[model samples]
Target: MPVVFRFFSVFPLWLLHVMGAAMGWVVFAVSPVYRKRLVENARRAGYRFGEVRAAVGHAGRMVAELPRLWLGAPLPSRMTGEACVEQAYAAGRGIVFLTPHQGCFELSAQVAARRWSAARGPITVLYRPARQAWLASVMETARNRPGMLAVPTTLSGVRQMIKALRRGEAVGLLPDQVPPDGQGVWSPFFGRDAYTMTLAVRLAQQTGAAVVLARCERLPWGRGFVTHFEPLPVPLDERLESAVLQINQAMEHLIRQCPQQYLWGYARYKQPRAEAAAGVTE
Candidate 1:
């Protein structure tokens, strides 16, 4: 699998996207379960098939671009609304970067870290290891790059994030991700009760970190990406549960901006997993 990814990494970005779009459609056609969930999730969000049909190809592009993102040359990236990040940094408190499963999310962290990690500190991101051992190994190798640190979704990892924040460093997480039992609370997302991670809120509240919402949008025809950074619509509430809901609402707003790039196929409504003895199942 790594070899295959490396081979694809050398392919032109446009060709990769084309291949990815085809891959997306093939999976959509062959896998009934994936197609069903994709359709249902889109419908639940009040989006019609016509409105979100492009998402199928977008998902494929996400996978196709990973090789280039992980092992190949860095794609050209530009940031807009960067002043928000600057302001956060100026606060001299940590930054809680909240990104949903939208656009080239992988690029979001890389962009921020490349630009700010040296001046501030490393950006520690919450990562859920793959179940497959081979994939897990590959993920670990790929994500542990300069200026970035990937921590597992465990209590220890949570502690590490908090520590980073208290030191005025940055930590990033996907608030839209469903956390394990005891790690998240059921909150309204897109008008449905989806289990949402409270870690982002907790980190901000505990350390007084500036909460920022950012997305790296994949440009057309593999041109590159436009990473946008901005502050949350409203400051996180002191109340933890309320803060979680606020982040969820912010996530909805972000996804709405580019529904076609959102991961409509993700099983976002699945029941939360029971916490293991280690208290971290991801």
Candidate 2:
């Protein structure tokens, strides 16, 4: 599998994206579960199929582009709203970068880590480890490059992020990623109750880190990505529930900017596991 990825990594990104789009459509047509979830999730967000259909191909591109991003040569990227990050860093407080499941999310942290972490401090990114041993090993090596540190979605991982933030370093997380029951709270996402991680809000509140909404938009035909970083629309409240809702609202705004590239097929509304659910309060 690594050899195959390496082989594909050498291909032109545009070609990879084109091939990925075809693969995406094939899956959408053949898998009822995927299709249903994609459509339902989009609909819940008040988007018609016509508006989000492009997301199917974008999701595939997300997968296909990983090899080039992880193991292949570096690709060119530009940033907008970069001043937001600079200002935050200059303040001497840590930064909390909250990116939704939109566009080239993987690229966002890499870009920031390279651009800022060296002068500022390292960015600890939250990610769930792959179940397969081979994949997990590959990911650990790939993610722990220069200024970036990838931590698993475990108790210790959360502690690591908090420690980073307290030390005036950055931390990145997908606030929209459903956390294991006790780790998240039921919050309104797209007018539906989705399990939302409170870590982003908690980190900021505890350490006074500047909260920013960021994403990397995949330009057409794989030209490259344009990363955007902006401040949260509203300040996070002291209350946990209010803070989580604010985080969700910020995520909703970001996703709206690039509905086409958002991962609409995620099981956003799935019920929490019974064991874990018992620990999470409604």
Candidate 3:
């Protein structure tokens, strides 16, 4: 399958984007809920229906650009880390890069570890491992590129992240992702309460690391992704929930900046479990 994707990567960008539009529609057909939610969420956020449609189309293009990101563009060649990393190092602590589920998230990390040429410590990304063994294998190989490490969404992985921070390395996590019960807190996202991962805030407090936002913006014609950085709005307080909400707002701010690239198909608002549903953090 990877070989097949490699072959497809050689195709023209315009053609690939067209194919991706069709592919996205196919997926949309199977998941009406996602399609409806995408529209509804955008509208609720004050995005026009026509604007949403255009953004959705750009999303298809972003999907097609995925293969290009991995096989065609090298991290060092594509991504640029700004004062973000330098600021992180000045703290003399580990860095926690909070990336949204927008535009080539995988590229942002690879570029930092392999390209930017910074004296960054260990770069750890927190991700939910694929359930299917075969598909999981492909994902592992594609993301586990040079100079980057994968931390599974487990207690073991959590420990590894803590260790990395203590060593003054950098760790990354997608706070927008839904976490298992007991691992998340209900926070406001797009004006709706979402079960957001609190680990990002906890890590910041535990390690005294500076929290920063990193996003990969897709360039036109599949040329490459431009990496942008922002400081998180959260304070360095010990309370997890307050800090978590601050980060969630930052993510929403970024989403508004590029509404078209944000992943609206995601089930952002769902019934919570006994822990999260009851607003229990500990």
Candidate 3 residue 159 C-alpha distance from true site, Å: 1.0
Taking the tens digit of each residue's C-alpha lDDT, what string does model 3 give over 1-282? 677768866776667778877777777668778789888878877887678565566667767766665566453235444676787787677888888877767677877777432466558887777788855776676666667788677677788888888888888888888777777889988788898888888888877888888887766554556888877764655677777888888888878877777777777777644432222122
Candidate order by decreasing lDDT: 1, 2, 3
TM-score for each of the candidates: 0.96, 0.95, 0.87
Judging by lDDT, tell me the better candidate of 2 and 3: 2
RMSD of 3: 3.4
Q: Pick by lDDT: which candidate is best?
A: 1
Off by over 4 Å in 2: 274-282
- CA lDDT of each prediction against the hidden true structure: 0.89, 0.87, 0.73
Native-referenced Cα lDDT, model 3: 0.73
Q: Which sections of candidate 1 miss by over 4 Å? A: 277-282
* Cα error of candidate 2 at position 220, Å: 0.7
Please provide the root mean square deviation of candidate 2 (C-alpha atoms, Å): 2.6
